[model samples]
Target chain A: MSLPELLRKISPTIWELPVTYKEGMRVPARIIASESLIGGMEAGVFDQAANVACLPGIIDYAWCMPDGHWGYGFPIGGVAAFDPDSGVISPGGIGFDINCGMRLCLTNLTEDEVRPRIRELVDQLFFAIPTGVGCTGFVRCSRSTFRRVIENGSRWCLENGYALPEDLEMTEEGGRFEGADADACSDKAVERGFDQIGTLGSGNHYCEIQVARPENIFDAATARAFGITIPNQVVIMFHCGSRGFGHQVATDYLQTFLKVMTTKYGIKLYDRELACAPFRSPEGQAYFAAMKCAANMGFANRQVILHRIREVFSRLFHRSPRDLGMDMVYDVAHNTAKLEKHIVHGVERELLVHRKGATRAFGPGMTGLPDRYRDSGQPVIIGGSMETGSYLLAGEASAAPTFYTTAHGSGRTLSRHQAKKMVQGRKLLDDMERRGIHVRTDSYGGLAEEAGLAYKDIDVVTRVTEDAGLSRRVAKLVPMGNIKG
Target chain B: MPYRFQDEITTADVAFEAWGDTREELFISCATALLRTMTAAPEQVAHEQKRVIRLKHEELDLLLFSFLQELIFHKDAHRLLLHADSVRIEQRESIFKLVATVSGEPIDAARHRLLVDVKAVTLHRFQVLFRDNQWRAVVELDV
Candidate 1:
């Protein structure tokens, strides 16, 4: 049957593919998208979602978020939970850039205050923060220091005088995951990561300056609770990952799993990229350990970037960072696997949840959230195209069907080459200028590749996530300026 | 007339196909394509300094993968835009060895316009094949 024919509309916002649709599938697959969104969906989305269903120990259904698109193994917006005892862990499910995530920084400055200095601010930010391909950061570390950053994560940042205490509070997992061994990483991984820390690399990674649109605030109480009370409140949002360190870790594991998956674990996969090992096996444990190191490094990476941003604000505004109130609102990882206890069918089960290109949208009262945000649920920051706008959302209890996950962004609708073919870089710059958005980029061609038209509408994507009850909107944020790598 | 690289559209990432009459030339062509992706004009990379890269893998596919990553590492580590002027690949038993002499100058903002940073070479759909007295390889880069 065709992909659309195999899907059964379970609700106005959800669709399902029964296990009967494909052989070897243990559970049915579910997709959270509106009819129109599903209509434009690529066949790869359904194929990958169904393939995930075939993996052993997968509980509930393989999930494809509204921002779904074809990825290496799992769909870019795929989410699945595995039974620790019987399930497996796949690096592809986590992604090449492990722990690639979004961080939102709340500031006291209003849009009006930033608007006048937007261009200069962006220029300052672009130069102050190392960006673009093949760039390094201000923090030059020895090999030992690199290992510590990998092992200790944000704690290393604090010790190095790059992070404040509160920065760790709002970070996911306190910016550290236990069991990370520096030895788990290869020498090559260390070499690649040695100088790239805190630098924003290329392709889709960015630091954007955004303003809260009062007119689009959906949940005022929640927004106010999150300290985004004023209309035109300016904030900074940036997306990046663990850099070359994570890539090497993933490469090292993918190779190991390919050899051991069939020989020792007796597991088989349809795609080689879906390389995996049982969660409890030695190989799996090692990868987990190394993955934690990468995750920690990712946190530290962002923490360092945060330090640079604060410094820029301090210098530009002629005030201390404390006076600027550049506090971290929250950080969320779109790509990761964590062991969480969730009640499945009235029984508490420790499931290994793998969220690739999906955000953790734990509902209110979930453990691990900061005290200030415990009552508001986990904050979900969905980065939209530079031209349209982005959003802040809160997880809903009603989203347990897919293990409390939501869309990461308005996922790509056009290929980079296709985007470049369709949009001219200079024209895009002119257009963004017309929209009153300041852009500072190393490559104008890179800017064209991320034009708003290249992506699905953010409003529609967020509405589907909200309509489906995965996450509810808190406030809409439009960019006033951006720095792209 | 020996070897060239052609870009392919996959999804969000970048992919390319490189071909040559010999495996050594194929490797050089692939690395050139990679350098070109990072900048618009690879020819403008002056041979101000040179670096040697050596890699060994049991399989040719992996050897190429590591070899390209090695070049990218130099570019990122030292901020150099390198071009592989000479490449030699040899197989002994099951393992393959590659030695390349690459030369380029430090990135000059006035002369070179930077593009996407090729983060890592992916194994997704990665292959190296020989057909019709010609060698071809397909690599997808995580940009």
Candidate 2:
């Protein structure tokens, strides 16, 4: 069967269209979705994915995660790998929010044990960890220290007493993109990132407590391997990135690359946002280096936030983070660019893989994994809106076809404005409260902007991801308390 | 629409957005909204200059993106408050082209207060469409 034909009844959750569906496409298109969720992909999302296939050296299929939605040049929740020799790195693939990813930290306490202290904890967190749109945090690093952050990522946090040595082992890419070039970053990107460390930049970035009830564990063996503790143990998970610092680096490089895409590399793009230079071109090399800086900043950002959370927990529970049994579970960046090896046409090929709005789901025993999780696949933290449930998943065998990637979140279904207009802030707050969800926000608008109704049904989305053989589920998590920046 | 500068976000409004009949107008409105959010109207004139820039978009979505970044370029380049005086969209066989003329004046503190630097335009929640017999562009920024 052809791609689109195979899509016809591939479990109400899958959709595929072959190269013949779109002229000039080098690879076919596959969409992991269910019927109800198909509307989310209605707005030129498939068209964007087809464009991705048309690129010079795309491999396998331009796969769209279940939460896929229309984005700049590539659909959000999109993943594609390009062969290094013939492939290109489109800024659109990694997104402007570099390393905007998730980190899950396990705690010893359960929902019943911490229910009473939730409010104070969130308040303390707000004070200790800066939030809001332009929020800055406690860390006041000098330029040299900022450079260290750019160079070392979470490692800098460990040296500065902000993270434990074990934390680095648990982070994807070991908390640092291995090939990052610190010197390639500009002074401005560094300046913007300095005070922003440990801060939770606003709009969809949040800190939440997920209740991992006994019944929610999907993979018992995998659950046991991750130190998730008992059935009722509570875990804290949050999503953020390098903040404006990362944004600046991506913006600066994107503009520079757009200016030279044709003149320097003879590369013509279907979209300017997809503007790219060759991987080794001066512009491309600079972007890759600068991109590493942003990725490191994100690692440091999450690491610092973890430290602040530790302080908050110690104060409320009268136990140190270690005593509370709080330890890093994993930190994985969904938006990133990395050079990894995968088999193409039955031959091992090095490819530049860009995963935007997607997470790396490297399977068990990848050498990069910490010893603690080597027997189990890397922990893939898939966060959903506060009202919905999230999942702890592991990469599956099928991931090898597309670089072990999966969807990021319950991708947006409503624009922020539409959400605010549709779900009034006061009502949304009341509804959440009525449902036993405790919510805090830097601005009520922020709350409204993230109204759970704005996103697709995460349950259905993740099921599709699993059904499609992208990532396998381990546990489901429901939020008890949330701090939205 | 006259620009309504939003700085102090009320519990009721998390962020602001703009709409227009043309992609250019929608982008200009968004640019004005972004500038208004960044700082108050120039109460004290800091400086002034004019910037001419170009934007090309293969999709209606990127056209809006290029237009917003053009405004960012002006804000960073001239250190002045800008208002798009005019905009024109020309479509080639494969791309939608934009030529805009904008004016900027020095920052007048009495009128301006920095709100948020729209770090960059995201492909997230970006849209350009024809609806209800009109062209409308919808976009959200990473503030």
Candidate 3:
């Protein structure tokens, strides 16, 4: 049967597939998207979402966000909550890049003031932060020190003078996770990640300078609360992850789980990438600890990158970061599995929520939100393609249904090869410059692969999410300068 | 060429299918494809360094997976560009053993036209098959 035929419409923006749609499904599968977005989705997305429903101890529904697309095991925008006592943990649900996320920093300067020096700022940033494949970082440390960095996350950055106290307060989990045992990580994972603390690896990873024009503000009150008061304000945003360390940790655990999933745990999977173990088992606990180490490393990685950004901006503008009003708005991790408290069936229960390519959107008064944001909802950063504009969103109280999860980015619509074939990188660079956006990239081929046409429309994605009550639009940010790895 | 990139199989990552008359040739073709994904011009890489790898896996597909993962590890840890120069596979008592020699140099942004980094190999639809008279394998790489 066709995909649409098999799905039952739950709402205008939501679709559901009953457990009978697939064998061994523990619950229903949900897709949150508009009619057009649902029609554009590939068959693999529905299949993968259904595959996730078959996992053990899945509660309520396995959901795909508005920007959902085909992924290895779970759809990129997939979300599922599992019962901690009887549920299983799978690396595929969290992704190889443990805490791959977005960071937004606000500055007092306007686009008009920084537009003239955009080229210089971008050039310096490109040089200060390593980019492209196999690039290392400026931060050097011993193996033992690296262990502490991973275990402590951004706290190590604070002690090393790479981060400020306010930065941690604005970050998710204060830029660290407790009970992150570095000994659970493999030596290979350490060797691969130790030197990569401040580097930006390639493949859709970038640091961009954006502007929040007055005309694009959707919620002036919320925007002002989040520090976007100036007209044509310039902000710095970057998308990256834990780098090689996270990948190695995921790889090591994946192989280990595959060896024992069916042999020792008596579990069967529809896809090998979904290999898993009981959450309370020794192997599962070890992986959870190791995954947290990578998560901490990811936070430290971005913290150091923010340090570099501050230095570059201060040197170029002849003012300190504080004097320039370069304070963090928020940092949100899109890829992770965390133990969170949520009310299900009128009873509060602790659930291990896996959000791959999805962000945690906690509404006002949510327990984990920082005190400053207690009145206002958590800030959600939604990155768009370089050619298009991104969005600043706020979580809503209505997001309790999907465990406070929302879409990550404008999901890809075309393959990298297809995008490259559609446009020449040199021509794209010239075109972007004509449109008042400066870009610096290490490889033209990589740049071509990331052309704006490669992704779904950001405006449409934000509209759908807001329509579905997953998140609320705050402001739209258009790029002024970008540095791509 | 014994290998070709299959663009239609994946939307966000790279996928390739390789085949050869023998398992050794198949391994070399797969290795070459993996290198090509990292840089558009793999031929430009020089043989300035050499590393020998020995691995054993009971399954043929897993052996290939481990072999490709090793290449990615060297790139991330040492910033090296490698191509498998020689591969020999032997089966003994339910274990498939692979020994290979790879040669390349440290990555230089000025010298190499770098592309996206391949994070790890995914087992989605991953297969190693002996069809008809040839050995073939299908693999997808998460970039």
Candidate 4:
């Protein structure tokens, strides 16, 4: 059956596919999107979602967030929870760019203070941070040091003076996954990560400067709690991932899983990319351990980049970061299979929740949140394309139905080739400049591929999210400067 | 006819098709396609740099995957612009082994107008098939 015929709309924002819709499906599939968005979604979105529901030990349902799109195995913005005892773990479900995530920083400066210096700031940021493919960061370490980085995560950065003590408090999992075993990582993975500890690898990865527009503040109290009380408050946001280290880790484990998934575990996969092993098996455990290493590397990578951002601000303004009130708001991972305990069937159970292209949106008072944000839910940083606006949202109790996960970003709606065909980088650059947005990119062609038209409308996505009660909007940020890799 | 590669598929990521008269030629065409994704042509790269990639896999599909992954690894780890100049693939007792010499140079902004950085190769709809005396492969790169 076709996607529209296969899907049954339960609510205006939620659609359902009965388990009987597909022969192998063990549970029903849920797609969270408005009618318009669903109409525009590719058929692969539901196909992949149904494929995930068929996986063994999946609890309740496999959910696709509002921004769901076609992905390799799990649909981008897909969320699934597998029983630790009976379920399986698929690397493709966690995505190749492990811990590809968002980090937001609150600054004391306002839009006025940054507007005049936008060009200079972007240039400085572009120069200070490496971009493009194979670009190296400032943190070059020996193989041993690289091992330490993977094992310790942001703690390594703190010990090495790249991070502050409080940074971990606002970061997910304290920026470290406890079970990370560097030895589980392959030599090639380590070699790729050794020199790229803090670099911003290319292709949609970026560092952006934004301002919290007064008119866009949805919840003043929540905005104040997030350090955005003043209208036009400047903020810094960056999007990056684990770089080659995580890519290699996912690649290496995928190959290993494909080799033994059938013979060792009696598992059959509809897609080769969904190759997996039982969570308790050696292969599964080893991949988890290595995945944790990559996860930690991702945290450390962002931590170092955060430090560089602070440095740029400090140097440019001739003021210490502390004096400038440059503080971290939050850092969240969008791609991960985190071991979390959530109530399943009204029974509390520990399940491995795989959120690919989706962010964990733990509701108010959820464990792991920093003390300052105990009253409010964890901050959800949703980045938009360079030409659009982004958002800072707080988790809602309504997200429990989907394991407390929400859309990670305004999901891409166009292919790079299609985007390039519709827009030219030179014209885009000029347009952004005319709109008072400064952008610095290493490749003009890359810039064209990331044109704002390439992504779903962020406003619509975030509105659907809030209306669906998955998350509550806190503030909206408009870009003033952007640095793309 | 020499193998040819084309970027004709449209998805959120990059996808391309490569075809050749033989598997070896298909592998070469695939490598060229992977490199061309980062830049327009091989002529834009210099031959001052060299990277030797070797891998052994039990399946031909996997061998191609590893071969492309090796090129990406070199690009990320060493900033090399690779163009596989020579490729040799042989099967020994059901094991497919590939060794290739790639010539390139460090990425120079003045010469190399880079494109999207390919993070890894995805197996989504990935295929290598022989049809009507011609070999063809479809690959999607996670950029």
Docking class of 4: medium
lDDT agreement with native, every candidate: 0.87, 0.76, 0.93, 0.90
Shares of reference contacts reproduced by the candidates, in order, are 0.57, 0.12, 0.73, 0.71
Q: What does candidate 3's lDDT look like per residue over A1-485, in tens digits?
A: 15657798889999998999989899999999988889888888998999999999899999999999998889899999999999999999988988999999999999989999999999999999898998889998888999999999999999999999999999999999898999999999999889999988988899999999999999999999899999999999999999999999999999999998899999987999899999888998999999999999989999999999999999999999999999999999988889999999999999999999999999999988988888789999999999998999999999999999899999999998898899899899999999999999998899999999999999999999999999999999999999998
lDDT of 2 at A198: 89
- Model 4 clash tally? 0
**TM-score winner among the candidates?**
3
Task: Enumerate the candidates' DockQ scores in order.
Answer: 0.57, 0.14, 0.84, 0.71
Estimate, for each residue in A303-327, the C-alpha lDDT of model 2 and write its tens digit.
9999999889988899889998898
Superposition TM-score, candidate 4 onto the true structure:
0.98
* Residue-level lDDT for B127 in candidate 2: 59
DockQ of 3: 0.84
Write model 1 residue lDDT over B22-43, tens digit each, in one string.
8898998888888877887677
Candidate 4, residues A350-393: lDDT per residue as tens digits?
99999999999989898888988889899999998989989999
- Higher DockQ: candidate 1 or 3? 3
Winning model by DockQ: 3
Best by the lDDT measure: 3
Q: What RMSD, rounded to one decimal, does every model reach?
A: 2.1, 6.4, 0.9, 1.5
If both were scored by TM-score, which would come out higher, candidate 1 or candidate 2? 1
Off by over 4 Å in 3: A1-4
For candidate 2 chain A, which ten residues in a row score worst on lDDT? A1-10
Clashing pairs in 4: none
Instruction: Show the lowest summed lDDT stretch of 10 residues, model 3 chain A.
Output: A1-10
**Candidate with more favorable, higher DockQ: 2 or 4:** 4
State the iRMSD of every prediction, in order shown. Answer: 1.9, 7.7, 0.7, 1.5
